[model samples]
Target: MTVIVRDLRTEDRDDAERFARSRHRALPHLLWTAEGTLHLLAHTPPAARRRALVAEADGEVIGTAQVDLVHDSPEPGQGCFTVYVAPERARRGAGTALVRACEEHLAAHGATKLFAWVLDAPAHRAFAERHGYRAARHAHFLRLDLTAATLPPLQPAPPGVQLRPAAGFADDPRPLFALDLETAADEPSDVESGSAGYQEWAASTWEHPMLDRELSMVALVDGVPAAFSLAHTDGRGRYATAMTGTARAFRGRGLAKLTKNASLHRARAAGVTEALTGNDGGNGPMLAVNSWLGYEIVATEVRYVRELG
Candidate 1:
């Protein structure tokens, strides 16, 4: 029997949800939803040429591949395809078929360099190496059981400091942007992420479909947004700590932990059962914070990059 790979139909909600579920089981770190998966297909820039491809076996969706160009980067011909098959369905050629279709589509659009993230597992890494991708940066996926873990006690904001929810900035979020840019300037990553323009950040972060502003905690110093714990939820009781950082000028004050704990407490109180977060392998301080908050290592993923000729 042969696997049939084709573009996903927006009307096929059940099939799309299965694809998303397959990805979640394979790699739980990523944030994905059927609505979000479909949104990307509809809203991604034309230059990106993004699409979601599903592999069907006996009329059942068995795999998903997200193919797109690196349009945000200044470089050209940089395409990427992240393929995930139901773990139980591997070795049936669904992964290979998805990758082949992605390569053909991107190559036709002038792609020479491709990037993909593979788990550090022997089999997954071997699969990527077989396809010419070399390992790059590695990151960790951490988790905390909100209902059972012991969270750090809240500390009163030091003199002149305050703590609040990001929803307070519903009218103006530029201050939060400044704080984000300041903290992101030093975030550990294989690919140096640039500061997205404020308008774009508003569109991508503030207006993102999954953003939970009420759960996003922000630390303030004399009325200035200085640190924050950005939160995202899947609307199904799963919470994720997206970012926790303090401004460079305020680094040693422990404000990041302060806001993060506040957010976590709020999440647990609001019925969020499981919380997820990720830390760069080399980021010791952030890792310590997560550990202190009862987050444990659940999985690891390695990033792979291939240069374009």
Candidate 2:
């Protein structure tokens, strides 16, 4: 069978659907949707040089790759890509071909270091090693059965603190943006991510199509946005926490846990059955928090990196 790699057809719904299905099959704990994929393709900053690529074998979409530079990272020349093949279609050379295409595209865009995520499975690690990528830290995808698990009871807000839905900030989300900037800078990652301009964050994060503003919770201390738990939904009873963080001064007060717990309760009441989140293996505080919320690790992915000569 011959494998062909090419850029995704932005206007093709079938193409987008197939790509999203492949991703969900490969990493089911996280949310995936055709509309979200299309929105991402259209909203990505131009400086990122983002490309959504797919692999075809025998006229069927078998694998997919999203390639782009770490445009907002404090460090330059860093490229990132994630490739996943339908489990049944593995070893058809689709993964390899997609990787080659991603590397070529990123290198052309001046990327000197390429980072890829490989599932922790043995075969996946071997494939990455064969491509000259070395293993790095790993992250876990966690899942909670909102229908069965008993979420922690909501607690009264601490003095001067109030719980609010992210929707309340729709008229002016600048405060959330500022909070995101503060929290994102502190997130644990292999690459040091930095926030782009406010407009860029608005297009890529705040205004995202999957963002469920009503389900996303925020903790305000005396009218100041202190912590948040962002929610994203696929409209199919699947909900994922897009991000959860607390401001520097608000870290020890259990504000993150409070907002996230409230968000989960709201989501469950709204008919969301499955809630998903991902955390760095080194983020013990968050890992403990999710465990307390009854989330279990469903899958793990290792970060792999290679330096381009």
Candidate 3:
């Protein structure tokens, strides 16, 4: 069977949906939807030079690749790409075709270093190694059964701290942006991410189709946003915490756990059956929080890097 690789036509709903379905089938641990796929393509900052590629087998979409420069990183000439092929469609050269196309695009735009996330299976690791990529950091995807798991009881906010939903910041989300920027800087990763500007965050995160402000919980200390848990829902009974963190000054106060627990409670009350999240393996604190919330490690992916000449 011949496989053809081409750029995704975001304007075509069928094509977008097919791409999303392929991603879900290939990596069920992550949350993805047709609308969310389109939003990423549409709202990606121009500086990232993002490209969404689809691999077609005969007339069906069988694989996808999200390729872009690490525009938010301080390092120059860095690019990141993740490729996923439907389970049934693996070993048909679809992945190779997609990677080749992605490399060519990134290389043409001056990317000297490339990073990819590959499943920790033998075959997946072998594929990356064969492509001259070396393993780097590791991360895990966790899932919680909101319908059955016994979540910790919600605790009242500490003195001088108030818990609220992210919706309260609708009129002005700059505070959330500030908190996100601070937390993201401290996240463990191979490539450091630069600040996410307010305008960019507004378009890509605050206005995202999957972001559910009402289910996202935030904790304020003396009327100042100190910790937050950002929630994303697929509108189909699935919920995921996209991000949860506390300001540097509020880290030791257990605000991260407090906000996330509140969000989970709200999600469960709203009939969300499953909850998902990912954490870098090196992030022990976050992993401990997820563990306490009854989230089990469902899958692991290894980050791989390749140096370009």
Candidate 4:
């Protein structure tokens, strides 16, 4: 059977659903939905040169890849690509085909360095190495049984600080965007992202289909947005923490912990059965927060890097 690689047809609902299904099967710890997938395609900035590729075998989408340049980073020529093949379709060469197509597209866009995240399984690591990718930083995918696990008791808000849902900023989300920009700048990662402009943030983040503002928690210090936990829920009882962060000045007071815990509680109350989150291995504080919340390390992935010739 010949496996053909082609760009995903976002306008085709079936194609989008198949792409999301492939991702869900390959990485079950994270949430995926057709709407969320389409939102990514529609909102990607033009300068990013993003492309979603699918590998089709017998008219079935068996693998997918998300490739794009790091547009917001100060450095140019940096690219990111992640490939995933449905578990049942592995060993069919779909993964290799998708990766090759992704690399060709990225290189044509002036990408000098490419980074990919590979599941930490032996076979997955070997496949990346064989393709000239070297393992770099590691990250963990944590899971919490929101329906069964006992979460920490909700703590009273600190003096002068109030825990509120992100929806409270519906009229004007600039404050939340500013807080996100500040925390994102300090996040531990290989790529350094410059401050995201309001228009960009509105299109890509605030308008995302999966972002559940009602369930997302925020910490307000005297009416100022200081810390927040961005929540994303796949209409199917699955919820994930898109991001959890605190402004620099509020870092030491456990506001990050406070916001995340409050969000998780809200998620459970809303009938979300499973909660998922990811953290860079070097991010000690976030890792500690997840552990304290009874999250288990369900899976791990390592970022692999390769330089284009």
- Whole-model Cα lDDT of every candidate shown, in order: 0.84, 0.93, 0.94, 0.93
TM-score of each: 0.91, 0.98, 0.99, 0.98
Q: What is the lDDT of residue 28 in candidate 4?
A: 95
Which lDDT tens digits does candidate 3 get at residues 191-239? 8768777898899999999999999999999999999999999988999
User: In lDDT terms, how accurate is model 3?
Assistant: 0.94
lDDT of 3 at 302: 100
Q: Candidate 4 on 151-235: residue-level lDDT in tens?
A: 9999999999999898988899999999998998888898775676899899899999999999999999998999999999999
lDDT of 4 at 184: 86
Q: Which ten residues in a row are the worst by lDDT in model 4?
A: 187-196
Backbone clashes, each candidate: 0, 0, 0, 0
lDDT of 2 by residue, 1-309 (tens): 999998889999888998899888877877889989998989998889999998988888889999999998779999999999989999999999999999999999999999999999999999999999999999999999998999989899999999999999989999999999999888789988676689988998998989999999999999999999999999999999999999999898999899999999999999999999999999998999899999999989999999999
Taking all chains together, the TM-score of candidate 4 against the true structure is 0.98
Which candidate, 2 or 3, would have the higher TM-score against the true structure? 3
Cα lDDT tens digits for candidate 1, 1-309:
689999988788876687788788767766778876775676666777888898999988788889988776666678887888888888999988988898888888998888787777999999888877899888899999887998888778889889999999999999998888888879886553345788767776777777789999999999988899999899988998867889988888888889999999999999998999998899999999899889999888888877655
